[model samples]
Target: MAESPPLPPLAVDIDGTLTDDRRRLDHRVPSLLRKWADAAPVVVATGKALPYPVALCEFLGIPTTVVAENGGAAYVERTDELRFVGDRRAAEAVAEEYAAAGHSLGWGEVDLPNRWRETELAVSREQPLEPLEGIAARHGLEVVDTGFAYHVKSPDVDKAKGLTAVADALGIEVESFAAIGDSANDVGMLERARISYAVANADEAAREAADHVTDGTYGDGFIEAAERIRAGVD
Candidate 1:
């Protein structure tokens, strides 16, 4: 039998990696995360804003840093320390630019009544576009095509940046990391890690980019990926 490689720190995506298509968090995934946390740091990196990951970490009983709003913001929950990586002034400038171009930008953190633990930004289509590429080209933001909606985001803010930030804070190198996800947004983090896994339900782009493709979906898929990482296979 081949010897297993050393286990690495885990960075996981939220929506599709740990939850189902409906966005409900599964209990088993958190349990498995905690199990792994005993040996390595497990960071939750998600496109969702701060509150979601904060709720998740609290529910999971895992004391880990969270990278929220893609890579725009990060937070260490234990200390309540927050880092706004993306320039707020820059974000505001971009927002103005988009608005001037007649594109609707849905600001994620703006309307929330309570102060957020992390920074988050979401750009969505308020009106239909005849050609989607036009908007993307105009703003230089990546256009993500969801089944029902279109999302535009800064090219700089991505899952990979978030993962790297968390790893750096924890003093873990990129080579000693594993990433798992199921979307185009997850592609960066997937590529950044030494080992990357895409779930059965992952998008084609994500699957193609991943080092390994898991047979399971959602939480079950993540569990399977964790098992494979523990067992050590490229």
Candidate 2:
């Protein structure tokens, strides 16, 4: 189904799409994903770090175009093009404020989520959002709850920008991509794609942004959307 007649490329989110309810990888998807990779160019867009998306694609033997750290960075593997669009220091400042208050990120104690994160910061959902939001506002940053964690980054660095950057690098249009996801952080990317879908379990913002909602949940929903795309269903 590799775009024989030039259908749009595909942009996918990993955590809620490729993972099950527990956020663990679904064994069924890797094999099915190769067929997806064959359908069109794939962009692994996620709020995760740069290494996460790139490594996942490499392991799966898929082409790598990543919008990582919620669009804080965009990297295209074939061209060796990499662009970062956010200020890391804002997140660092938020960390400092948290430290002063005797708190650490990602449930404290050597915050693993932010370890490889090059830009912005991710706080554990256990942290209170009010104070964090206040701190973020003061620093001109915004906090997004991606269900897995609380992401603190710039409003200007949404996934849409990252998708656009990746599309341009591939000589494609952002509007020519079909996107899928299940969280608020994915809203911008969903809105930018020509056709977008929300997994049945998607959060409110994501569902609202998507043009369609699949009957399946999580990975199944993703696969369903991919099949529809391959079948050329509008």
Candidate 3:
């Protein structure tokens, strides 16, 4: 019999998966990431700005891709190819509407990453999501809560779209990959990949969408996922 194909690359979330809610990477994560990189491609899919994810990839000394701005942009490290995927104007409009609602918005309190994002507007999660969804709907936009913040983005653009693009760029089948994340933004990608994991700390919806929920939380769960993938458990 022919040998089964090797597992495809891993597409991982940044905040709340590889790092804690406080935004610190556990010491174990980098080594596990390095090992994974040695075995196959590791793409960092995140709601963070391009530079931030790129910086992490750099720090790891791993040649990997990044899907940033909640699927709005992706960078292929080895090729230095950058692709922008979402509606920037729509995102800005959503931000404006949210600001008009008199809620503290952008670069205040908890959303420092707001200034760095160009295609997704970061809104305070403290603001009720129901009203924010209504505001987003007015412009045909979408709102996703990423634990730390709420993101205003194009309804059609999301992590799944970004992951597909990265898979295409790498000439790999999307179904061959594994996706791990812990928030509403990650649900789409989780559902799309053949092998999907929701870390123990994942948002309820994300946990529901995933094929497996890791036994550990945050970095620990991510490490567990890596082990499961290597073990070929469905």
Candidate 4:
């Protein structure tokens, strides 16, 4: 005679979790996510710049709530709230030091990744990490590698903080949400969510941090996790 638990809302990663290995949007994903949005809130969290995730929510027909730039910015649609982690002068200094040390920003002179980024900086993954970490540390910043790129940000800021902001804005606790991810930047979110899923192709840290590891990869993995969450199955 025990009552069933409530279905949790979702906070999801965009790139490797929603896109295929080619990083292309899986045509099946938007519609599936749109369906889920009808029943519960679905947060599209990503390490990309703010505009990307926000626009994604619009196109996907989900709430525009999102955590972008690897926790550097949090947007809550319900309250029209937009918050940034902190001043990025430190991250900017890191980039200056990195450039002086003969390291390329990796994406070329007019790097598109850094174009709209407000609170952090992104270096292409192709660049070596040896001195980049040291450079960031000197400026009191941390460099997080999200598989697609390396993000220079404040040590205290992360996707978990963004999730907390979203929870607060929605007047709910984060424990009432399910989260899925495929990279290191998502580790904090996965660990804090009520239920966490790491796709088959997820890195070691993410897999180790999740409650479940999906059998599929990319968009398919998200589908699997979503179905399991709805079924209330582990």
- For candidate 4, the 10 contiguous residues with the lowest summed lDDT are 1-10
Per-residue lDDT of candidate 3, residues 117-224 (tens digit): 878777766666876788888888888788888888887888899988888888888777899999989988999998999999998999999999999999989989
The TM-score that candidate 4 achieves is 0.96
lDDT of 1: 0.72
For each candidate, what is the lDDT?
A: 0.72, 0.87, 0.85, 0.90
TM-score between model 2 and native: 0.94
Instruction: Name model 4 segments beyond 4 Å from true.
Output: 1-6
lDDT, residue 226, candidate 1: 90
Backbone clash pairs in model 1 (N, Cα, C under 3 Å; residues 3+ apart or in different chains), count: 0
Task: Extract clashing residue pairs from model 1.
Answer: none
TM-score of 3: 0.91
Name the better of 2 and 4 by lDDT.
Answer: 4
Q: Which stretches of candidate 1 lie over 4 Å from their true place?
A: 1-6, 77-81, 87-120, 123-140, 146-150
Ranking according to lDDT, highest score first: 4, 2, 3, 1
Better of 2 and 4 by TM-score: 4
Model 3 off-target regions past 4 Å?
1-7, 109-111
